[model samples]
Target: MIPFRFLHAADLHLDSRFAGLSQLPQAIRSYLRESTFAALGRLVGVAIEEKVDFVVISGDVYDVSDASLQGQLRFYEALKELGAHGIHVYLIHGNHDPLDGPRLQMELPEHVTVFGAGEPGQAVACRRSDSREVAVISGISYPTAKVTENTALLFNRKPGSTLFHIALLHGNVDGDLQHETYSPCSRKDLIGRGFDYWALGHIHKRSILHENPVIVYPGNIQGRSVKETGPKGCYVVEVNEEGYAQLRFRELDSVRWQVREIPIEGLADEAEWTRAVEQAVEDIREELPQLMSVVRFRLTGRGNVHRILSEKGAAADLLTELQRRETVRAERSEYAGLVWTEGFSVETGLSIDRERLLQEDSFLGEMLRLSRHSGQSAEGLDDLLSAALKPLMENRELRRLLAGAGEEEKLGWLTSAAELGITLLSGVEDEGGAAGPMFSNGAAAARHEREAEE
Candidate 1:
């Protein structure tokens, strides 16, 4: 006979908006929005497949207590499906979904039990067939968004009880700085507390805090940003007759986020750069074969590729080409398994002696020095730029034409002016820096607009 089984999941964070990405195509945006819901559906499927007795969701069921109606409706569908399979769900509210916060208060399925705040809530698990006792589950929810007290100490497990015990909690353990310190507690506070398993939440990265007693964090089911990278899913645990547990992590994210920094030190030209980017996509596809991936790419180091990117309109053209690789299936608007570039950045610098240029006693050198200072200290730069543009803004007719370039725009122009001059001057020195073009009306070049979006 199977000893005992259950699924441990937390930090669902449904309807959580993605960060660091803007102006995504409609189809891609839909994929990102639906990813959390898709993971919940998969979680339900896993419970039915594994034939687990129950599902324990520690906390943060919604991104907010007053979550969107769409998020609640979708979540309802998944739980309804699991209930149909005879699986019971035990849940608690986290900092994001506090008990006192606004909620829809919709009636949940009969098999779903949510623990309340203040005093820890208690429930017992039993076999549906014969009413045989399985385990005792105790948990507490957040009374409000800010829970400073150590709620973990308030649990009651009935000492010397014959049945196994499981503690469902959502809090910061040992004041983990990566997460907000709520319901604070220590490993000492949790251990030796008669819990056979500790189902925990609030920290979005999966961590096995301890074994034997089996304390763990399943992490979030979906990766909402580059910071939450790699495989994210719930843990399927099997407890033997003696109460020892084994864990298996499953990936359910519909879309994955990643950050890749490629060195462009020796890449020769635009063709090589394109090839490198393509390879990166292929590599990520290989790394995560089950889900679609969105990458934030940062091209680094100095190379000929940097010079081409410095040319006007070339970077945008490359981005357009990269986006062209994405394909939406004709039948559905959901994300197909195509690799999407969330954002692209070029940190590669010019291949000239910047230090010597700044130190030189020439007109270009002086300009470089002044521009450098203007870029370094944003405080006084705005005043100088605004003064210079005052003539244009003061003229009644010209103000109507040029007032759009505000203080921020002027600041950007001053910051990039030195690099633009260097690119122009270098172009006149030779054909692709070949040492003999000398004012030969060289090929037109334009500076790249931005270094990074974030």
Candidate 2:
């Protein structure tokens, strides 16, 4: 069998703006602005370095509003680089870049072939070393932004001319609740086609629906928001003599996004808390030492630091100090990589000695016991606990917060009643203690019980 390799990528979303951010340092902002283009350049670098036979981009090459002249020129330049290396390029437009969408009118390089929107098309790629057909790639683009048809069903089976076949698609297969159901289809439809591999796009998370025939989603090359966290890149695929394919994920993202929850338990003072946060940033930098990172941190767990952190504007102050340190680190560092906190949130409670509180033998102790008992066995405490929490849940402000919260999230908030109780009783003037008045009505004991049920 002739050895052949290809790079599979999707959802470039070039020139797309990063959401949920503002007032960032100029250096970080500059990096974020060029991250998508840099990721594409890295993909082209991979194609040249691996000397792959071809590259397949599933869809969404650019944002709907960003088909500017510069965007088109940058995309063309990348393709020209690949064509110069004798690597073939195959692509299909997705919902964001439909056939009729606004775009810069330009011609791609001779080696680049884009499938049609109205119908599926085939492109046979031949190995440069052997001059023989190595793979048959079939694909179709979206004609409009909303295509509810089962587009995968339109894909024909592998032709008799090539042993290795790949289906490049941009649709929601088996539906993901987080995304729209465009060109939706089931896994059965793809498996039935007997294609060697399915290159998928649109859902921004990498997934492998099957291994027997190698179906894959390479995800987006760059993450543009907090929701899109961790490493984002593409897959390099190689076929063996027996027709078995091996896939390996490559890191092409110039900037990475991460959300970390750090427990503040056992931390006694603000200094300790800051040290812990610094350590987390160091750990993240070590993990992705080559790429710059934008991180959001949530301080959790119960401790004395909770009181300090719960003060008004405490989180914002911490973020300011963190950003200052980030600037200093960047200036002092000799390396190219840098890391900074995008935002900080405090979700901690007051440290409460639950065992000691339980042994009080007073009304509060009895309430705590009842809360624990209700959780263990819903036998008798469900109604009692619900009644106790009713006033809090009915509060105009608290109700608003819990209005969209699911049962699990409600349970989590309810279970933190002990810490809230301790803070309120101490009159710490803390944010978490603000909920203390509602719990003072003896209804707070239901927190533990609610947790057990959850």
Candidate 3:
């Protein structure tokens, strides 16, 4: 038998947040802020329950640049518990918790081993009484925040014949667009070193790059935002006597954040919209324990509802109302609690008068053409447009004007301009011409109406 069973975990972005949790209700805000520590405790609990030979935290134990002494002490206490059980704990500093800093003043337990920031080195862990000898455990810690050079060069040495070689690292493997390319390396760099398994971290999403050498990122122990969705947890690796390894993901997160998009194509009334929103929440609730998850509901699809839902006050109010509901509040809110928001847009049940509008030869049409072209090069045009159009879309007077405009008056102005945008975007003519009442079209019309109203 392999005689060694271990849990591999990384990227515990402890005490982190998703931009604006403070603005939510106190109950939810408090939960969101405290969930990180809760997840960390869960990790230690799993380690004890499994009775593994050792536990390896690849990197990023906490998120704070200057983590509190209390937080560090809490973590030390957890490790100490494992130490008491005669289970050794191994760790390395990731990008978030680089070696250089205002260090937390705490003495680690005897059974704990933290990799240093110097040249690549190995830590030998063994059980003499059982005649069990695990080969060289090699690892390197992040010395600074931005490590650009290849750090794999440090761990080029192979292990002796009598031991199982395991290497731990905290850096981007290759071109991971989601993360900065710190200490970049490749599968070849790791496998070439003749290591048995490469315990890696940095990316927050769990993935297995290579199985032969057992390269893995256990992801974050808990999710922190809508971006980090689905089942958040760690991995358990069991290495057999012949060096063959089997990996299984173990769920450890207390509160998971999920993003779900609900279509509104045929929702005819307020009841239907409410039901749809409820359904989205229910789906998430069904998939996860209500009391342990927060969901971000994104309203998608084409229809008049898009206009109503996209309005800043209406949208914000809807989210607030959803947050206040008992079913949502009690179950599906974030540890901080739940707050819904609109997501990506798809065309709704609205049409434009492309032919008649394109016939116009006016300054507005030329301006539209300019907007279309300039929008291409504009880096943050979407944000700028959204900000500029808020007042117009919300104004009752502006909506009435938009809803009642004639072909010659309204269609001619907007169609020509829309074509310019189409040309810039697709290098083609505006196939969907002068759309119906701006409010009925979708977010673009509502946005434009808001701008006009302003």
Candidate 4:
């Protein structure tokens, strides 16, 4: 058996837009716009640096159903660059970029070999130094958008061939409920198949289902959404002369996405929280020092600052300050490797304990008791929320937004409403701007003054 090495990457998603994002600064937007292409470049850089024999890109060559011309040309350039280095590229089409999908008329470099859509295709990867065949690569592309059949069954390895075999597939395995079940196959079926390695794609999270024969998913090349966080890259596999493979993961994404949930329980006021937010960003910056990244913050836990942050525009104002803080860093750097704040949400509860509030023996107490009971039962919560939100549902925007609101989210809104009511009606804020328990201050009534004689 001859020794060889190759880079395994998948889900290029070139020219893909950042999901759930808009209204960005020109510099950040341009970086995001070219993020996938930049990631591809980095993958190629890693491949060259590692001196791999070839690169196997397992499906999803483009983001769109029909390949975009810009993405196609950019991918072609990358292949051409690899060709210049005498490195081969074996790629296949996934549901997103199928073989039958409409694409521009352009020929890829000679070093690039594309597997066919009709049947499982085969290509031999030779050792770079001697040009001796060392590995057999088998793969297939989706003929159309929907490939529900078990396509993995089509693959058949050589009867007694001693060459290393790698299979590239893009589909959902059974019980992989996180992604849509496309070209479904069972783990038993894949493992039973005689292949030295199984490089998978379509699901954006990396996982190694088996190691004996090396079944793995390298995840997407770029983090196009906040949901797809952390380092996104490829696996470099080195097969020693004894026919065992050592795998290494290399992150090639230039732009990363992250979501952080920070608790603000001890933080007292806006000043403390502002410093806290800056520190959080700095910590993240140190962690992802090399890449441009976006972060969304979910501030949680009961605190006095929650009341201050609950005021209208406080969250937005904080976000503005955060952006301003990063803007200076952005101006200093070319790509703004510092963390940029995408969104800041206030999800904290009131400092006063709801259990104690429910025993107050007043209307507020009864309301809190009802809220607690409603949250315990799904049907009760839905009924209470629907009736309470009926008037507001008439507004198209609010109606559209809340239509998809789940039981927990609606319950959060309900809790926030009650907190607002108690905070305002009970006048919990002291003269020193401290928030005491709801109804802790002495009660006062509106004077019944005789209407001034007009």
Candidate 5:
């Protein structure tokens, strides 16, 4: 029934490279390179500031196979600093950094306790102030790259133990499809162990499956790719004298990856469209002021300027301008909003109303009907898209992008294609001449009118 506090963190993934990013700006790339280390430093800073009894890093401390010796040295220095503060650190190696790998052998400070790799291990730490046993932490490290055993089954409960019992584990629970099913175990299996807390890893999204026994996943300290978005951080947990506990999430990432969808339906012209884009960027910047984030925009909706927006160079040009805007701010101010637009896709259609077009007894009406019908029929759209994308499927790059695309994603791609086809056809004149550009004169005319009024 003693009160205690501890920091629970996992998936450090130190020295991991940012994946799926192509041609990022130099500044952003440098930040990505250092983000994992920066985040770990912040976690250590939080633990020291909170003055926690100990820190539990569940797994994936540093990959011995892929990570550099420099990363290993930094990892050790962090634990050494904690040891100097008289704080204990309990760590376990995950699949990415198993014990059997060609890792550096170094002596850690006496305050650091790493669980054994061959089997489930136990380590007890007494409170320095009172010289009484305050916590008993149990965990295991991966002995090989692939550990298929349900390791949670190895844990046993003490009938009337007084100290707080915690289990640190790194594996999938009930076959989590998001990750490799290593050291897999069921939630029921863990619940039966009767531990006071379960600190889990291998899933990069924080989750609390059961609060009764305080089972938690603090997620990775830093996101290493576009697939991993939003804020990434760890948790600080406090257990009161009565045995009840509280969990607090702490945000600790310097950069983030996000996707935003903005509709351009009601935008009158290029000026209005630019304003909308700026507004969205500002909103996201406000939401994540502390982190420098990159966003990929999905511009969707039928509009008068659909052709202008869908031009071959529109998306690239817009992205360049947005990036320039952020760079200007970065140069001018020491502390300003740090957001960059990575790239975008223009998925738009003609302003022609579909219901009205369908009423016409012509090719346009027939085409609209066919597109709608195919979208409604499950197999029709799938077959059409499969045939259209057959040639592209042979390309390794595109194949990677389409690997796990579901029905909805395929349908979305087809819908965008159909919309683009309609827009092109609608703009073609009967005389075989291209229609005049759709860029409106509204902005210039407005300026003229304002000058006249002035």
Candidate 6:
């Protein structure tokens, strides 16, 4: 049996948006953005420490088409460290970093082999002095962003019997909903190619689609945003003489993005809210060690606390205070950093009587009717209205606007306007009295906008 170990990783979206991390102090923001590079260094350090045979980067080394030159250079330096340690590196460009790019001009280390965009693929014969020639490493590159052709067909030609065949690709094996369907292919197509191992990329979550041929996605080396959550890292695979394969996950992420949902049903006061938030933070900090974390705490369920949380500025202030305490704790640790962050958010508002709103055959009822039947243009109006009303509703500004007006006057022109706004935007209803759909999709979008503004 060939005795060898290798690191398989993908989707290092370097220099990407630090959306939630932006709330962090400048020092913390710098650390978070640079964490990907740190994770890359750690990956190399692991390879050197374990004395792995080679390292494979499936794809998406960068985040955007026009990435920073400094970022590219940093990547080159990290890969060069592995090369200096006599570890061979194999790489292929994924959708994010297609082969046809100016950054590819940089000179790479001798031990590193980057698969270019060409006919079929490139193969490297792996031979050791004592043992038999063990494996044939082949890979294809994404010449452009859209690769609809079946690239797996190129690997139909198998390696000699003396060696195992491994193919590294940066395309979607199939149209997985969790990811964008780019460079699509089926499991059978890959299996039929007769390759021993298929190292795939593009999707941010790690998964083993097929074990027989050992098709794997090592996920991203680091989580870039809230969408890509939890532990991010690479895979270490071992193949024995019998062609049986074993895979192990190695977390190389330097920062983590975590989501925690805490129900507000029983929270009676500020003290309860503080206690709940503190407990949640402690739990998350314990779970993730020695890394910066961005946490989104969602308060759910029915309770009196919901009213307090929904009351304009109270919710925002409470969240801010919670984050402040968490940051202090993290700073004292002197190892891991904590950035409790909130972004485009929603808290269930006071529920209203839907039946009563529908019973009144007035302008409010008519507006709801029109909203339900509206087409795309109406949908656009809804979106616009949602953008306008979310802040007003959340801040209780709408309630203030109607203050002092008699019932008839309140339900007159302004009520019609508010109902029209709700119809156009699909927001909380304006029950002929007070109370509506507490929160709506428009509220969510407005929250997002506010977060962005911050």
lDDT winner among the candidates?
Answer: 4
lDDT of 6 at 80: 79
Kindly list the per-residue Cα lDDT of model 3 for residues 199-262, writing each as its tens digit: 9999888999998888888898877655677777878777778878889888877677666667
Descending-lDDT candidate ranking:
4, 2, 5, 1, 6, 3
Q: Go through the candidates in order and give the clash count of each.
A: 1, 1, 22, 0, 0, 5
Where does model 5 exceed 4 Å of error?
327-336, 352-454
Residue lDDT tens for model 6, 1-454: 5756677888887766565344565556667777888888888888887677778888888865547787798888888788787778888988888876557476787888888876556555443234345677888888887787777777654544546778888777766644556777889889888887898988888889998888888898887666677898888877777767788888898788767777766678767976887787778768765777776666554455545564444556766776677556655654374655653244444434444666567776666554444322534444544554566666564644433234344233333454434434444433333343333323533554354322
Worst 10 residues of 1 by lDDT: 445-454
Q: Candidate 2 on 1-454: residue-level lDDT in tens?
A: 5678999999999987776555666766666778899999999999888888899999999978776666678899999999888898999999989989998777777899999976689988888667688888999999888888898988997656656889999999877645678989988889998798999999888889899788899999998876688889999998988888899899889788788988988888888888888899889888888888878786777777766765545566877887887777665642245777777655677666768778887766776776676555443444544676688885885665544454454455456664556555544454543632222211111332232122
- Candidate 1 stretches greater than 4 Å from native: 128-130, 286-290, 309-317, 327-334, 349-454
Residue 72, model 6: lDDT of 91
Question: What lDDT does the true structure give each of the candidates?
Answer: 0.76, 0.78, 0.66, 0.80, 0.77, 0.68
Q: Report the lDDT tens digits of candidate 5 across residue range 1-454.
A: 7888889999998887766444566656666677799998998899889888899999998766567887888899899888877789998889988888776789888898889776678888676567578888899999887999899998876556778889989999866554778999988999889898999998888899889888888989987755577889999999899888799999888878787887878888777888888899999889888777867676777775566665444556677888877777656542235887766655555576668777778887787777788788769877777777889999995775565466787777666655655556565432224543322223322343333222
Error of 6 at 433 (Å): 5.4
In model 2, the runs with Cα more than 4 Å from the true position are: 328-335, 354-433, 436-454
Candidate scoring better on TM-score of 3 and 6: 6
Q: Can you list the residue pairs that collide in candidate 1? A: 312-446
> Candidate 1 lDDT, tens digit per residue, 1-454?
2378889999998987776545667777777788899999899989988888899999998867338888888888888988887888999999998887766778999999999987888888875556577888998988888899988889767767877788999999877654678999998888867787899999989999999677898999998876687788999998888778999998888888777888777787788888888899888878766678878777766556665665544556766677765744412542556687765665555566778878889887888877877766656676667676786776885665354455566665675555666656544332355322111111211111121201
Any runs in candidate 3 off by more than 4 Å, and if so which?
Answer: 64-66, 127-131, 310-313, 326-454
Give every collision pair in model 4.
Answer: none
Best by TM-score: 2
